[model samples]
Target: MTAIDQSAVETLFTNARTHNVWKDKSVSEQTLRELYHLMHFGPTSMNCQPLRVLFLNSQAAKERLKPALMPGNQEKTMKAPVVAVLGYDTEFHEHLPRMFAHNKDAKSLFEGKTDFINTTAFRNSSIQGGYFILAARSLGLDTGPMSGFNNAAVDEEFFPDGKVKSNFLCSLGYGDHSSLFPRQARFEFDEVCRIL
Candidate 1:
């Protein structure tokens, strides 16, 4: 495969910013669906796509999530065009038959293994969450992914069925660029990485 152009690279990574304040502009439903279609193709172990997203776009829906969010996250999340309640499915392995058809024994690997299931679900879904951010950026939308909220409260309020567990929340919309804080420092390759 060919390398993506630098412009696209900047769109997804280099110039992408995690927005806190959003503009009054709205994000279209069609764009949200397209975003999912693009991000779902990202790889997961055994192709178990465990990440389940709940998009809260209406005031009433956002209100339901209000109590779960920390004080600082409430205003920005409430005003953002979309707030995605990202979760991981506890029973995601049940779909392994269809997701990992090549391995007839795939389902058995996670079946009855509580610790294993939870770990796989959380790890793979978090990877998908990262893909979700890039996919939104590629679609020209701004993102704010944060974890300052209460997880238990979110799960009880949103995922009452007890199957999907709340992982994090991400706000999406047109950002108020002027309100952005200066970018923080990052570790250099030599500081955080090493060659064998």
Candidate 2:
């Protein structure tokens, strides 16, 4: 019978910021695995965990990514220790029997509903991506989530088979505050929310 402390939770939410620059340090593969293990618990629509991630760490892979990025984002992405391609599987509904609870034949729900399936896939994958950022931050790594890359090119380069599509990219590493701009402002809770 103990009251939940709000301040501690708030610190995790508020203190995390999008870091554009990173230190020379590298993030271990074990840490990335731990982050995934923690983030996997976040809920997804129909329990269909459609989010697929490709971690780019080597210089060659990062170089392959440079041409797909916006001019503003290239350097930040290239310098980070790890760059994650957050993507969604186009045929994720095919595995619904295993992913969706109580729905033994869940694939039938999307049999003739391609649009619905795609919408659900993207929606849930985006939620999972948010969870990933929080999980990385909780593990003491900073994140710079950006949508400044060319999706078509990224798809061509990484997911050439076309079964999955890139949603966004996140750079992870020890943050270099030297390049960070001042913290941006946010709307007040009253302005952004409504009490029903």
Best by lDDT: 1
Global local distance difference test of model 2: 0.90
Lowest-scoring 10 consecutive residues by lDDT in candidate 2? 3-12
Candidate 1 residue-wise lDDT, 6-40, digit = tens: 99999998888999999999999999999999999
Cα TM-score of candidate 1: 0.99
Angstrom error at residue 133, model 1: 0.3
Clashes of 1: 0
For each candidate in the order shown, give its overall lDDT on alpha carbons: 0.95, 0.90
What are the per-model C-alpha RMSD values against the true structure? 0.6, 1.8
Look at candidate 2 and tell me the lDDT of residue 113.
86
Q: Model 2: per-residue lDDT, tens digit, 1-196?
A: 7863776465358666789888999999999999999999999878889999999989899999999999988987999999999999989988888778588778888877879988988999999999999899888899999999999999999999998999999999999877788888889999889999
Deviating ranges (above 4 Å) for candidate 2: 1-11
